[model samples]
Target: MQTGENEQALRKIIDFTRLLSIAILIIHFYLRCYHTFYKLKLTHEVVDHILLPLSKTTAFNTMLFAKLSALLLLVVSLMGSKGKRDEKIRAKTIVTYCVTGLLIYFFSSYLISWPWLYMGATSFGYLLFMTGGGLLFRMLKLRLGGDIFNKENETFPQEERLLENEYSINLPAKYQLKGKERDSWINIINPFRGTLIGGSPGAGKSYFIIRHIITQHIRKGFAMLIYDFKYDDLSRIAYNALRQYGGRSFYVINFEKIMHRSNPLEPETMLDITDAMEAARTVMLGLNREWIKKQGDFFVESPINFVTALIWFLKKYKAGKYCTLPHVIELSLVDYKELFAVLSSEPEIEVLINPFISAWRNEAYEQLEGQIASAKISLARLSSPQLYYVLSGNDFSLDINNPDEPKVVCLANNPQKSQVYGAVLSLYVNRINKLVNRKNQQKCSLIFDEFPTIYFNGIDNLIATARSNKVAVTLAVQDYSQLKKDYGREQAEVIMNIVGNIVCGQVTGDTAKQLSERFGKINQQKESVSINSSDTSVSRSTQLDYAIPGSKIAALSSGEFVGMVADDPGNKISLKTFHCEIQNDHDAIQQETAGYSEIPFPSAVTSSQVILNYQRIKEDVKILVDDIVDSL
Candidate 1:
């Protein structure tokens, strides 16, 4: 932002500096002529009487050198103060200023020598002056129209200032830049902005995410946490990329088969009670949003509070391995007398335990039991054996606190395990989001594929605030209906409103209409036909219509996407719609897919990943050994 301000200041200074420079030249010319005429030492009579302002033609140009030198220093100092990438912009400004000065100087000098050529110089000067005037008028018009010329609204040509494929620290490249003028380097789209991508199946949305947003950053070494939904294809590709890049580790949370365990209670949150409470709400809501919606907060708030208090206690006091959700389920079903006894000795937990103990003793104890039962039923899967094994250990963790090394995590959507682990996924997202915002020492990118498949409410708020904390969220979804269904209509709207970059592929129904509305309106040429039926002639008139119909957006081809990305600082085209093409990489994809099917386990854990407990593995082996002995 300081860089942009400096550039604007330098530009204005150059404008006034040129006027001063011209004034200096005129003054110096007069001074030299007056000195020579006063000295009266010219050799030729023709030189003495040359034109109207005949005077000394001094070979020594000391005054001109001094004035021009001082002017150059001031302009150079201004250019030197701007930020790094502004070097190119500053160079261009300097070159243009020098060229304009040279043009005026040469034309004026020649016009004095051959006065007839004054006509041509006058014509060129008039043209240049008029062009500058028109530009000034446009700037004035824009200002009066309420577009404040600040860091956000400053205009720059984006087409010429391309940042290339190697640069990646934040979410810098959302769309290709259009810019205000030719020869102006292409500027990056919003670097610190969040994006939401929408596309139906096989519309090439995933391909777009890979090529445009993640791939470069992955290669450039920005830490990332990706939720690869379909088959862990994205995760596998990123794993290979991280390996090739070297020095960075890859982690996986495979739900289909336990490749590795990341204790679900890992660092519950550093913040006091609020963070833990929000996580509890997320889990309960994620499990049964419709139920909670129907019952309202009054019915659900107490259960959430109960869970929240437990979460806070566990996270604050216990190790991550022992702080699993199963502990909560076990405590919930235990006798109230036992629970009271357990809380009796712990002074810190008495405040938390008092409310639940009193609730159970109420005259409406059965009603309270029903509410507690409802929350427990929704969370009953947490007590299952397979999931318990997966949530118990600390084998792999995906942390994006460090940007020098990138990280990626994949959560499998196993049907058998979905009910058990769905809430865990929500918890991880909520926790990771907290980590990203809290441990904001380095920038991180989190990509959630088919994001609506694992909906959360705070996603909109995350998108809005993540930029400040240097975290980027990349969400991909099929359609608006899915969002509305999973997150409700109001939250879906909030998500749409907060996301800075909206990328849409071929979509139909409400999603198409939403994208069309978001891509906004455009002025398009049209034709109108008129007829005069006086038995003589017919007149036809053509005109332009100011609109882009929604049908046009819906008809976009596969691999083609329409987007409205936030503008870069100093970018001229503010919130303009752009079309991007992301062609499928068939061979590369085939390699990634083939590798996944061949792996004995999804990750590097072991061959028998389907089985969970180590004791179960031994039990099965012992049973087989006994059968073999009996056969012998």
Candidate 2:
């Protein structure tokens, strides 16, 4: 009862003070206006009684105190009587408003002589402080609470600014920020540093990312070598892009059709017998991927050395006229004695084959056969008529980036025959990497789709070193597990880490988790709400979390991609990471594709002619063996 009585007394006092301040303001305004405009002069009695008692030192000062008292009374009334507590308002804010208002009102004393100027300035000051200060507090509250509904930290750095240049591939994209969609771009500022694209099938990796890379790089006149693992899908794109973009030379090495043939072991490009040893290493590892894990094993080294001796022998035989894969396969299948006899006759490789010779002389034929059998068996799988016709002829050189005659080359592999076609394709990839990764060559791009279908021995090294040589390599795979399964874990990790740009679509398991960790973390806000029968409470908090969660990566839509890119020193990109949907003009691409013509056959050669050519290569190998034996 006593507390209620005290509250009522305080309310009465506040109301009386408010009314008294209003009356004082009215009296001061009226007296100031009448004296300033009408030139009214007060008698001494009126000045002493009315002006000195009511107006104090100045009418403006009297009005300022009255208005300030009224504002303070309102604040006191609210603070003393409240139902729900306001989390926004604090004692500090109330004190700040009071001090700032007092300073501004006192500073307006100079305008007191001009009644109109004083009133206008006071009114402006009241509106500016009270109204604007209230709004600023409200903004502070909202910022502290954050956007709890959309929990993502959309405060990421995103810019609509795009950087384009002769060596760049700019992709149009869009991202979300605070529930608003904004335009963005994935700027491949320096593609020479290499790009790795990973996603599941139907993830739009090829449709959204790879196709753009192909068309744009081709448009820029880059001598390209594309590995179409699914055959004509990318091959057709390469062909049409070449025709539309005006390339100097175009070639496709496909075994299933009338395709151009290029020797992977071309003599002028192989450089030396060590190059042959490298080729042997690549082919042996490609054919026997399990051997990648067992690289230093004697059996593995034996086969690689045997194949090297054969390749170097052919490269030496008749000035390398027969230094082709078909010839190598034919010679590898020859009798062990004759093969060793013919290879050992070459003084350069005598020591290379001495182990086999010692085993043969000692009648340890089983041990000798064990070493040579793997090579013969692996090389035998590639001994197809179509494969021979494709790999034996020298329709063009492997140096596609020869600036004088820049070539746009696409080599295709059949999915049904990946094992057979993969070996030959790996050889091409190995050879082309060596040729294209040289100084002063035409700027080139090597795009490998379904990269795990074939093995690239030094793919990590190529990506690491190719940037300076102007060779852009783009590798696409279904998942990191596939890469680990095919390329071995150590090599797969090296390839994954070496690339400068990475774009990924829907993927799950370790791949998604790995990508999530690669994207790093950002500060994000989370809200929790609790309700009881009597009351409800809400709380907000912030913590460092994955910018793109692994679940988000696993749940990414078809056209959505999340990745980071490299930037050149001259063309720096501040926001290198992204989670965006590549905006492709489907209508334009479809219409353009509709106008594309079929790739023309370079010759009128028939399947029977291909068979005849295959037989002739075998006959050449047989006759060469005979001549070498006769000379010995």
Candidate 3:
């Protein structure tokens, strides 16, 4: 009871001291004002005795009473402030206030001569000092909660970045950058440079990032080719977006259901033997990804050259009248002598088959069979009626970027049959790449989901050169190791380096480390404290550190993405990199998708028609073989 009473008495005295300091300042101001207005001395003995003793510390300048009152106010305020909720103020804050207050009290006394001017100046200086000291206290007292290692983590400015051009696609985003919550954008200012999206499964690669790219590109009227590896997942989005936006053209290539029938080897699409070679190489590598590492091996080159010769022969014979993947596959299964003899007649194709022909005539049957069997067996897998019917007809051309008729083509593959379909789909992708890369075409986007499932031959060349053609390529893979395994290390590295934009979520191991390194480093403040029985000390230092550490990337939650985007010269982005959660309207998307209409089949096919189509292709191949033998 006695202690409580003493504490109450002390609080009263502190309050009294504060009031007395304020009263002194008010009295000084009133006297100064009167002297300035009336031009008479208002001095008194009581004022001189009270303020002169305080002024002696600073040579008794004209700012005498104002300086004394400021000092008194500061002292009383500090004494009275136990801080709200009884929280103790930091020692550094208290010391800063003390030093700053004392400096203002003594320094203001020497600066002003007139009583009125000195009084106003000293009072203004004290107000400025208190505000500055409060700001410093807040800064010093900032607390680091949650992860300590994330303290001072670097974050670029999150401003609404956009090119606002017809060719660009911009996405809205939100983030906390430098302690301020900001709403911003992930602007693909020059999307033609290519984009690579990577993450583990369920990391929102399709949900947060790719979906936006699809919808935005469609909105901008880009003729697009989407490789939907999970069949209808992305296909549904493309179909619905097309309907919503009223796209000029829409088509789907699927083996199971009603699909658009188009010849991947349409004569105009494969302009020369080189186009055929590219097609053959893409197909073979897509089928046997292991062979990508052994590209120059005898067996690998032999099969590729053999397939190339067959495609060219079809392209030249009857002016590419019978040129289709089914025709090439059928020709591959014919007797080697008939096949080689027919191929040797064309001088352009003879050179490609000389090695095989030499092996055949020398009675090196084992080598000939080995050379031709690789392509024959692989092509044989794609010989079913469904693929034959699909690849043989020319329902539409691969020129998706045609100005007169821009098209949105979605080529979907079943994960269960990815190995078989990857080769055929790769052929389609390669052909479309050739078609879209011509100058003066409409702007286009080629989005490949599960990109590593198909081997995109000359992908490096495409990424390096296609920007001028306004072709935007987006490749999404689960991991870099998948690219290395499927596309070979050298080419995989080329693809990774050639891309201008990269977005990632929840990737681990070397992928996270590589991305972390790519994000680079920043100067960060690090604090360490040492304590002993005698003393406690804190040391602060700064060093370069990863902007977004690998561990943080590996631990990212769903919808969180870290990436850097390419910018255009006309509209530059000062902060191209980002660590953010791409804001999406979940309810809105759900509502939109909920009303989606299924992609209709082009025409219904019964079991009998499927069988009839299968037999007709076989009969055509046999008749062609017989005609060749009869002509010979």
Candidate 4:
């Protein structure tokens, strides 16, 4: 792993050769200058014949050129060999070599006759080519992606090996190099698998994500779905900037003022009666959280079906009026005498009605009543005052995928009042997954802070297909085991696998071990030696070791995150909060939020409106069922 000693050996050999070559050229010149007086014949025709390239006529020029070539070769070889780290190429090396070459060319020409030296330029050129060509060829090969296989400096084929040298991991290291170029912005490509941000509390994870990552993406015109679970910090931080700097619309589904409304079954989401029925089933299943272990019993499924059928009947007959969550609770409150009479002709809802009717007719209706009670209790939370307020009215809706005009939709769920807001948060996550489709391919980001708190059933499939839709997802959590606990082992693994870009901050326990293994192992050369009174032995061997251990991950400081960006697979990036002044102008931010200030709080719906909605649905269902029965 260490290279100082080996590089020193190579440097010594090259230095010795350079000095000897220069001495030979210098001593030959000294003898030639004194040969006139001493009448020396040390450089006779026989000696020139032995030295093939040292022709008698252009002797000084050829020798000087050879000496200069030795120095240039040394410069190139010492540029960045394994050991001598300090020998890396620098501005000084090129400057020194250029000046030395020019001086040698002139002095050699003066020593040999100028006319003859000019003739020996051919020999000088050959020497230069022979010395520098291999080095130049090597450099060209490295710059051109190396040889066909690139064995000399092999870059591992993606995930099989940890490419620690890649910019994704060794990032900012590349940026800090002596001379590097950059464009206006750093473009990261193909980063759609979503980023998983995990860090300890007070680790500055939120600040980095919002200030550095989220602000950058929004400025680049990416539509965002920011789920501010901690507070409205993300919403408050991004609201004005989104509209002013990003040139986009801003929508907030705020729970504090009931500032926004969302109908999950809204036609735009494409969740028809059957879809809502399935959603109801999923919700009831999640209430027990039994499905996280194994499939639910008949008792749980029976209640889910009964609720689904009622929701189905309401949504089927009432297009807009009675299909809201409030209506579902209102209809459930009606007496069985009136409810059965109203749904008498419908066969789909008959499944629940006949069972209740038969149990009553037989005077053994305890089981049927208990099922209704279970279903009602689970669905009751959906009709809570705050949830109904936020989910019922259609004062506004989030149009996230609009490509011509980008948008940022912030769903504010204050963690302090999580019990009141958790249901609505889960609803929004589910609804957005239903809304995203392949129709629009604009760049979008779904940022979920405190991700484990909200469980959306379609998240696995959503991440799988987001790349084609050009959507990115960022889920922030405190730990990895939390996901496995929320979603069972099999399902949790699926979710983690789909999110290829993992941005892990200081984490402990299983999360750290998992990431440490993911970084993979590297091949390193190690040396061992043994000495005794009788003999001595030395040997070098290769060993495999973890590139980055779990302890290192656990020791990461605040503002530092080890991430594997999707754009750069097989490599992990360790990023720190650089001193970057993002232009999150508060004035622009206020201007953006002001655009929606005129929207009033959702007005209370009167009893008359509720009755009218129910009457209209009953009338429509009656006519449709009559026609169906007539056809049958």
lDDT of 3: 0.81
Quote the lDDT for 230 in model 1. 63
- For model 4, what is the C-alpha lDDT against the true structure? 0.58
Clashes by residue pair, model 2: none
Write one digit per residue (lDDT tens) for candidate 3, span 1-632.
54988878877886777677666666555543545544566667677577546544442334565556555675656445432221234656656755675576567556545655666666666665665444443333333343465734666565475556787767788888667878888888788999999999989999998888898889889999999999899989988888889856889888877578889999877767899999999888888888989979989999999999989998988788888888888889888778877887789987899999899899999989899898898988888888887888777899999999999998989999999998999999999988899999999999999999887888889989999999999999999998888888898888888999998989999899999999888787676655555544456788998888999899988988898888887878878778888888999999988999999887886767767877777777677677777887
**lDDT of each residue in 1-632, candidate 1, tens digit only:** 55988878876776665555444444445444454445665335554355334223332255446334434543443433322121113334444544674466345545544433543463354345433332322221112223322212222122324434333322222223223222322223554577788888888777645544566566765667777676566766676666666545567676555676766566544356677677788788778757434435656876777677666655554343235565555555555555445444445556755666777676567766765667777777566555656766667554555555445666666545454456678777877777677544566677888787674657877877777776778888888888888787788888877887777888888778777666554433222222233222223333432133356556767766666656655554443555545444569767755664232354455535434553453343344334434544
Q: Report, for all candidates in order, the number of backbone clashes.
A: 10, 0, 0, 3
Q: Output the lDDT of residue 294, model 4.
A: 56
lDDT of each: 0.57, 0.82, 0.81, 0.58
- Ranking, lDDT, top scorer first: 2, 3, 4, 1
Instruction: State every prediction's TM-score relative to the real structure.
Output: 0.63, 0.78, 0.78, 0.60
Index of the highest-lDDT prediction: 2
Q: In model 4, where do residues sit more than 4 Å from their true spots?
A: 1-188, 285-291, 340-364, 404-406, 525-540, 568-632
lDDT of 2 by residue, 573-601 (tens): 87888998899999999998898888888
lDDT of 4 by residue, 119-168 (tens): 25433543444334323322211122223321222111222222332111
Instruction: Find the 10 residues in a row with the least total lDDT in model 4.
Output: 166-175
